[model samples]
Target: MMTNEINKTTGLIHNEGNFVGSAMLFPFNGKLFAITAGHNLYGKKFTDVPNLDNLTVSDHTKITHPIRCILGDSAFAKSHDIVLLELDCKTEISNFLPIRFCTIPRNPKHSLMFRGKYKNTEDPVTHRAITYTSTTTQSEHKFLCQIEKSLLMNHNYSSGSDWLGGWSGSALFIDNHKELICAGVMIEIPNKGNDGQLLFVNTLPLKDLGFESDIINAENLDFDKALNAASLAAIIDSFDEKTIREWEENNKNSEQLKFLNRKLNEIYPPDNIVKNKNKIIKQLLAGKAYLTTELSKNEQIFKQYNSAYKVYNLDSKEFYVNTKAEALTQLSGIKSSYEEYLIGNLGDDLPTADIKLLAIYGVSEWIADCSLDFLKYE
Candidate 1:
């Protein structure tokens, strides 16, 4: 492995619309793939992933090729904020990107001990914060963070670390020198008032999210040299909640509706089984439409992004809450929390809704809404 001075850890988020995270490189299906946080690409447009040939690093064109976005309440947010993508790269077999990632499929293979220079402490909580030198900020202050925690704070929470922005999705390696190892995914910088630690999510806990299977690692002689090499195959378009649901609903309804119609035939028997042809046909059609609408509605709602709604017995005016909240209410005294139950066990299912393309205004307006991500499980 080539060795050089630890270069400045600054990444240029090129995915359209300023996805402020680091890119990951991994091997997938005989080609190199790049990974990013899923929520970063939710509500985007594109058919195929982009390549450097189409757009390069820090190019102003970044506003065009958006990353695929994941929802706040989805399972992706719970286990980990990770997404694997493919990149178009042509490199020699012997050469690998300086920072390469391993799939969670084999994440255990690379586990090792971490010694936090900033945390000062040795042991780290699995998803807790650690200390890392800030490249963007001029302050010598250490940052507080927790992304799949791998280190403890060297000093107590005197001040918080400032990741600035665009540091999420960054790959962290423990002991970059002798005991080098790929560790976690960076999500955000700690607030100035945070307990002086760098935040990151460990890739280990998120292995089950299928991100590792899609990782596209770009090997490099130097960290900076690996920019284009490390970036994932640009998502020429993203399948956001708005798009995924529509695509899934249309495709699923077409297929399931056919199946349901056949089932209806079993129940109604094609009218030939009875004598009143037009009357029976008309009655059958009406019933078929009603059932189809109900079931199809269920399937459609089930396929949308991280939202859960109760089949409100219109009689009950109170909005339903989830069991997670109910469980919390037992202690927190928010007794009404138990009413809304999550739509799915994993909260990965999509909600049925007519989705539309998100304009710049839509995103700006939802900044606060995005922060208050409604956890279906919660």
Candidate 2:
């Protein structure tokens, strides 16, 4: 989405009686408010507090609204550059942008997009760039992301024009083929003539600081919904007698082939549904699933996942795994973990860097090596 198109959800934030930066309007706890960089509200480098009475945000129509309160941790202490301001008055929900929670893309080649108002310009500008993640700090609450210049350099504008001062607190968004999901928020920008890498804080840390998890959960649902829709669309688009014949030849013993054929025929039956292909595709493009209900529940939503093999916990209804382990190994780990939880031994040690690393990266490498060694020629 472009800057001019998203003005309804974007606004200028006035800090301590000055135009400090821009902020994005987001839904927080069933209400709407402006969220901006903590530095903007707490003063440069977080040295002084801004005048709360003078703190304000202006919507697309330039109507100013007073801030009710500021929430979240200190920028320097928590390493979270976010400041969630509670609104003193309610704004029209239609005028604000929809809030979407999403994880930062780990793929370096992934194209990311964000829009922000430039200090020198009247309109907000859109940017499309690839991301480079810098080293994670010890806090793990914040990480620096470098917004590399767009591969398509057809434009004449400078990189600073798209990601400089007055852009802090602007939402960095990515289209998930469903909706515009926010991945991060702008915190700092490189000086002019420097490699214009925009730095921002991922919004995930805010959850630990007491922001509701519901928004993130909804984002996951939207993501899954979009993926399913896209997959179904591709299958429908590629369906044909020749394709069915090829599938039959390739998967003669596959049990799922019959089910796939039945579903395809049901959607594009040679008679009635074929005529409505255009309309169906339009809905699909709008992120509507062909199926009325969810296909399945994905238990593994946490980014702290490390496993390819998941064994469900019958007692807690949770899924846990460390790698592609045999059924016996998985069961043993589950039993130990559950027992620890029962005896209150598990809750004592909060998650540390080692746990986080293990969860995120897994023991897959070691497991693979060991399995190869033990099962060789077996």
Can you give the TM-score per candidate against the true fold? 0.32, 0.52
Q: Clashing pairs in model 2?
A: none
Task: Return the top candidate by TM-score.
Answer: 2
Give candidate 2 misplaced runs (Cα > 4 Å).
1-5, 73-78, 146-163, 191-193, 215-378
lDDT value for candidate 1? 0.33
Give candidate 2's error at residue 367 in angstroms: 44
Q: All models: lDDT?
A: 0.33, 0.52
State the lDDT at 74 in candidate 1.
39
Q: lDDT tens digits, residues 1-378, model 1?
A: 211211212123444433434454444456544444444343122123343333322211121222233222234443355555444444431223344343221122111222111122222122212333333342111122333322222245244343233445555563223312354555544554343345455454445544443233312212221221111111112223444335335654454334333323332335542332222233233323322322133434333322322232112222233543442333122112212233232223322111111111121122112211122343
lDDT digits (tens) for residues 152-198 of candidate 2: 12246655433356788887765323555666778776454256466
